[model samples]
Target: MEDKFIYTDKERKLSYQILDELKDTLDKSFLENDLPMLQVQLKDSVAKNTIHRNVFGLNPILCSLQTAAIAVKDIGLKRDSVIAILLHQSVQDGYITLEDIDNRFGKSVAKIIHGLIRIQTLYQKNPIIESENFRNLLLSFAEDMRVILIMIADRVNLMRQIRDAEDKEAQHKVAEEASYLYAPLAHKLGLYQLKRELEDLSLKYLEHDAYYLIKDKLNATKASRDAYINQFIAPVRERLTAGGLRFHIKGRTKSIHSIWQKMKKQKCGFEGIYDLFAIRIILDAPLEKEKIQCWQAYSIVTDMYQPNPKRLRDWLSVPKSNGYECLHITVLGPEKKWVEVQIRTERMDEIAEHGLAAHWRYKGIKEEGGLDDWLASIRAALEAGDNLEVMDQFKSDLYEKEIYVFTPKGDLLKFPKGATILDFAYHIHSKVGNQCVGGKINAKNVSLRTELHSGDTVEILTSATQKPKAEWLKIVKSSRAKAKIRLALKETQIKDGLYAKELLERRFKNKKIEIEESTMGHLLRKLGFKEVSEFYKQVADEKLDPNYIIEEYQKVYNHDHNLNQPKETESAENFEFENPTNEFLKKNDDVLVIDKNLKGLDFSLAKCCHPIYGDPVFGFVTVNGGIKIHRTDCPNAPEMRKRFGYRIVKARWSGKGSSQYAITLRVIGNDDIGIVSNITNVISKDEKIVMRSINIDSHDGLFSGNLVVLLDDNSKLNMLIKKLRTVKGVKQVTRI
Candidate 1:
């Protein structure tokens, strides 16, 4: 490469200054020998048109220097990360190869640069943070945790510089990515300081007015807030000092983004938000004395001020998964307002501030088992194959607070805050979760949907007959549980589908009918099943009888073969009623209209998904010539459409008929007093409605029942359902 690009005097001076600062943090030998050579190479590459300004129009060399500075100062990263950040662009632009860097700077540095180049390539393909790209990005980060730290530092640098850029749209896009992606990553890594900075800066660009309003309010109240913090901290500081605790305290105000979130969450203004600042008591203590000293300080603060027991968080005993160790409490301070206090040792504070980098410093690189576990979870979530679900799992894993619980054998378990009993069971094992009927929490039985709390001792109760259901998805909170449940459900569906297919084949063989694949596929399509597996699944579930399918298949097979065979002997017992004539239809011809005003045709409402007046209805031709009216959303409508599209006819209700249609509503609620009466009372009160029967089943503190009612139209049925929903102890009411 030729040295064609020239640096100005000022630019050369600034570069040396950055280099000197980096030298202060990095090794002297590397700075004296390798850095100058690398800088010369980067300059030569720039002259060869291998480097360019980023989207924000930042000079690549200066930006890389600044990003490396952030990595060193803010994230506590060392030489390998800085070198990779500096040289990644050269490798990405093909000016320098990975192997060349490997020979010159060692494999560790080259590997990081390779990871960074991979990320850069992904961005070039799609700059937006889409699901597939996001997954790839996470996989790259998982390869080397330092890559993530470097990226976070780089993002912070970009966010800091883009404020003055000319492109408002680009600024907003970058800000949104900061908020959605990088901020959560920072939080997950325990980089609180950088996380707050990223968030506040993101809010400044994303929600301009709201950000400024909170910032301006904090500014306006700074003096009073300072006075209050001082007055509140004075006594606590005096007591702690007298108690022989070597600790320093500082009052830190909440981030603007945090305040805005509180305002939106609490639906209040800035003035209405209390505890706007936290008191951090960072102690200078050795590793062995850290926990006891933190607890002593916590006791001192709580004794001095009336602590709200509910607001206490004792992470010092069992530090966060990200290596955050602190004792937090909210107490009534001077003016009787709540103030949050954090107590942690210096080592803990450093780890909390710098995240995984400082964690690696203390625990060493080989012991980062937690990071591996987190990466495994990310990989597991990606296996779900649903983009939105994977995104939700990623965000939730990043931001949601963890709750600690215990097993029956005294083993401690951690879960996200809203983790349910089913989540715990799934975490224990897939089989345990699948068969988990309920659980015993502290010797008291609770539902699988029950949310676990800190210190709760749980014992999952399983039954041999119990199996996973689709509704279990709503009961569980963790992504692992959801993924497991979906997998189990799918496996069961596949098993049932295979059985159904075998059963259908047996029926065909017994009838001496040679099954044809094309005819069968056409039959399934006419039955509204796009997939043979789904069609068989329906048969296995008994929603579609194998016998009915065989009959349909025979018709299609006969028709496709062009065989003019006489109709099979009709089974008289299949008819619900022998006479097709109905008194209601005879009295009112305009009440129901078939396709193209076809009249005097035999028709009946489908037993499955009973179609009523005012319901969206479609007509399906039965095995006989008669048409059956069914709700468009009928459980079997899809199969009907797929297999028998030509047999489906458009139908509509034309007039208000003097006929009552039977409809079933399912009600579930607490097993409480007069619950049945309360439900019946609502139906009885409705003048035009009649209750045919009520079948109630109560078990384990819950009641579920089916109420069959006769009404003239869907309007009345909807009203009845609404009224039933308002009844005491009624949790949910839905039409069956």
Candidate 2:
């Protein structure tokens, strides 16, 4: 046998004759130059699928290739895209290896095919990943942009052949995914025609009855609607011709899916749906004259038929963010039916039909700049994390409605609806959000939680001390704000942890014991603390006792060598006090000592009581702070006595020493200008007094506030209050 390439018997059955007709069609399209090589690759790829059947029991790869080629060619896409569409299934289905693809077709086709293969492989390995992630994953690899275009074509072809699928469950799953993922992707890419087709086809399977009913209604009303549309457009056409304008006029009916959506959204039946049909006026005018000509057409149309002002959509004045440009008006037509009239130039029409693809078609470029920027933002978010928050943001950016707001400098920023001022601030910069207190909207003061609307000018007010709060997560709608808040809170926790570690070390030094990592880990495990910062926060907040910690440490490590179990019957004497802390008990027999040997420790009167020298009192040995003296009959006395009897010490007040105690007093009265100054002036007269912080709130002619001050004794406090009561506008003052 001579060296020769042999075709498989199955490969010989494929009709090369059909490819000739395909080439004739490709010639009509702009892809005539690249047809010869693309035809060769398509034949080879289709030949490998002889033994394969899709879920629909047909040669899905061949069908998909043909369908995709036709689709891309019709949309005016170039040859490379058509070639990629043909080979999209070859490498992924094992018909050809990636190396073989690169060797035969070159790297561009290999890259696109590989991108699709990667997406399919990821979904296969991680089926738990959601449809939304799959959509995002496809876009993430869209650096080439051809991958996305080919993927879209693949979806459209699949949807076209979906009716042949015999498995209802498979059919339904495909339809649901198409509706939720592929349709939205197409919409965002500006493929309006393909988007509509995908939605209608998906709806046909997912919502059978509604789909059939809408289709039937459209069929039933077709004749009457045509007559009305013809009557509606006749005069407008004559007027435009007379006005020396060149234009093509045609009427269109809403897609079945679109009509169904309107009915469902407006909570109405088919009969109540107005604007179900539209008349499009595509003008042939130079770029400079496009706007003037569109407006003139609008005037002529409204003159012929009455237009509803509220139903007007002037996208031509300010084009949609996706680059859609048109002027649509709903006018009263024959029999009082509302018919929408759309006006646009030829270029706008091409862009409207093709979306991102149109940009490439007109520019003759290899990529779309706008879509590239969008995909880059999406990739940044996905690479940041793979959690629900990031996924939610990806979906929101893809599918949510956007509103544009202005800054104080008149710059426009777009945000999703329901986003608060905090989201806007964070979107501008992280530091701005961290320092934001509250700001003004259009020069009027507003809260940080205020929701933003289109065209409102926002100004963010900031403060150095305004840090992120855990509760802010609930108030913010954007993922960026939520992520920034989480990072800030985490940093604060880390700082608190370091502070707590230092506090624990200082306590260990006072006891002359060595600190070790194992000991700290053991303690954390014992207390069920997950993070070091959480443990430290509890200690700093006084929610955990340092005494219990010290006692537990001694019982675990410093006792006789067994560290497996706690010594349950340890006596109180095991805990000792130093002499400097205990020596004062001998000098003053009247002073009560807590825990026997816990003697002359530094102590202060509790601000809650402010007990006088002669008043009956008891001492509370706080964890790190030495002691606090409380009145024997204080309101908190019962709870203290019941909870920790061992921490309390017996005592009685001695009328012996002069000491000042800090106290907070709440004052309420009528609102007056000099009220705060007069109150402070009265306190200034006492030489023994020290003034602290004061906060005041005045509302509806009534003032209420808190004042922190130090007084020598109860007598002085009482006298100071008597003076405060006599001040101008002062009503009541009580120590809190």
Q: Model 2 scores what on Cα lDDT?
A: 0.72
Per-residue lDDT of model 1, residues 470-538, tens digit only: 999988888888999999999998899889888888988998888898899899889998887788888
Question: Candidate 2's residue-wise lDDT over 1-736, tens digit each?
Answer: 3222334454344434444545565555433435665656556754543235667754553565456564555354444455566666655666667787666655666766766675564444323223444455456534444556666677787888778678989889888777887788888777899899989999999999999999999899999888888888788888999999999998899999999999999999999898888899999999899999999999988988899999899988776656678998988888888788899999999989877656543422122344444644443443454211232334323323455555765455666668888988898898899899887876898989998864466899999989888999998988888999999888887887777778878888998887666676677777899877788888876788877887777665653347565658988876444343445434432344444455556887787776755456789889996788998878899999999888888765442435555778899999998888999999998887788888999999999999988765666778888999999899999877
How much is 249 displaced in model 1, in angstroms? 0.8
Query: Which candidate's lDDT is highest?
Result: 1
Whose TM-score is greatest here? Answer: 2
Query: TM-score for all predictions?
Result: 0.52, 0.53
Q: Tell me how many residue pairs clash in candidate 2.
A: 2
Alpha carbon lDDT at 443, candidate 1: 89
Off by more than 4 A, model 2: 1-18, 21-51, 125-134, 361-736
